[model samples]
Target: MSDLIHKDPTCFPVLEAAGLPSAFLDAIMDGVLCSAEAIMCIPQCLDALCLNNNGLQAVRDRNALRCFVKILTSRTYLRALTGETPGSLSTGLDELMRHASSLRGPGVDMVIEILNAILKIGSGVDASFSSSEPASCSTPLWKLMLTGAIR
Candidate 1:
């Protein structure tokens, strides 16, 4: 039984089709694997999109910022940040910060633009706000700061 399973190449199971070339079958399997990999890479792909100029523009846009603020205001935002949310959409934001240091050429420029956008967002807070208002220390921007993302 061990020989049949391990040493006997003739006994090994293989995908078979009537007229398909072996290479074609291999290509099909590769495509399936690659698709699965791409699905698993949603966070990285989203970060890539968000790091580009269009994404940066979207981030800097006032309307987009307003939408972002609304989402962050939710109680689940913290859980999402901590990667505690159930599902396939947990945070991979730390990857963006990690990439910030290793980027070059246009990548560096894009990162700078993103950081500038974030700084503008941070600076938008009024210095004269009432003390009765809740602190923003736990917000996503604050978490970015706490993580030394600026450095």
Candidate 2:
């Protein structure tokens, strides 16, 4: 199932039809923290899933933002950012921006609040995306904000 999603994210509807939306989302969220390969595959999965009405709702229903917060806050994700190119990270931010309006609701307020905090902290610093050192706990968070805003 993870392979299928990685191979063809457009197969989302089929997976949903098979009554596996929860499982599919779980795979995506969990995969993101597993390794660099899974991290790179995530933007494509999000692009395919969040672009459609049903798929977007499924993600929202799953409180996917909370999952995202968990991912963003994880040491693994920060390590990936500090050590590698921000390929999927940038693309994933783009997808999030594209779906920003659609992804809003009471359930998403927490995400919004987090973003606001990032913005406040980010507004104070000129973050260098080229740097490999993790500046602080919020370094990745601010980088993500700047990346998303730059698009």
Candidate 3:
């Protein structure tokens, strides 16, 4: 059906299990990317990314981290911050550091939590632990691990 083929799916936090329709996907993707700057706030957009198991899955499943990487590594932002394309990680960090002067308060707290999660994952903590139906706890451990990377 045309409607199904061109479904205007909402972006993250309202994900579709069905993969995107190839025919019109690029337009939708471009639209989402165009609006990404508005959602760069740590407490708002990134907060939603680190919310829970569903959120973690969304990041892993939806390739949200890659999207962030692209946004952060874009040439414009990189030039604004670093003046040259140093390398991969450096490119992203350059953009991340662009806002370094303004990062504070809750943003700082959020970054700390993210760093902790990244450290745990770096130190052999399983990144996908919670998605496997592990325990009876209200929260899943895997999500906690992903908080750093996705957010």
Summing lDDT over every window of 10 consecutive residues in candidate 3, give the lowest-scoring window. 76-85
Give each model a TM-score. Answer: 0.26, 0.53, 0.27
Worst 10 residues of 2 by lDDT: 125-134
Give the per-residue lDDT of model 3 (tens digit) for 1-151.
1223124313432343443322123332353333323323311332333333454344334433333333332322322222232243344434443433233333344446556645554454735322444333333233334443323
Which of candidates 2 and 3 reaches a greater TM-score? 2
Candidate 1 backbone collisions, by pair: none
Clashes (candidate 1)? 0
The candidates, ranked best first by lDDT, are: 2, 3, 1
- Please report how far candidate 2 places residue 130 from its true position, in Å: 24
Off by over 4 Å in 3: 1-39, 76-151
Q: What's the residue-level lDDT of 42 in candidate 1?
A: 33
Give RMSD (Å) of candidate 2 vs. truth: 8.0
Tens digits of lDDT, candidate 2, 37-129: 656665556555665578777777766655555455444466655445466666665666575566646335756766764564456443432
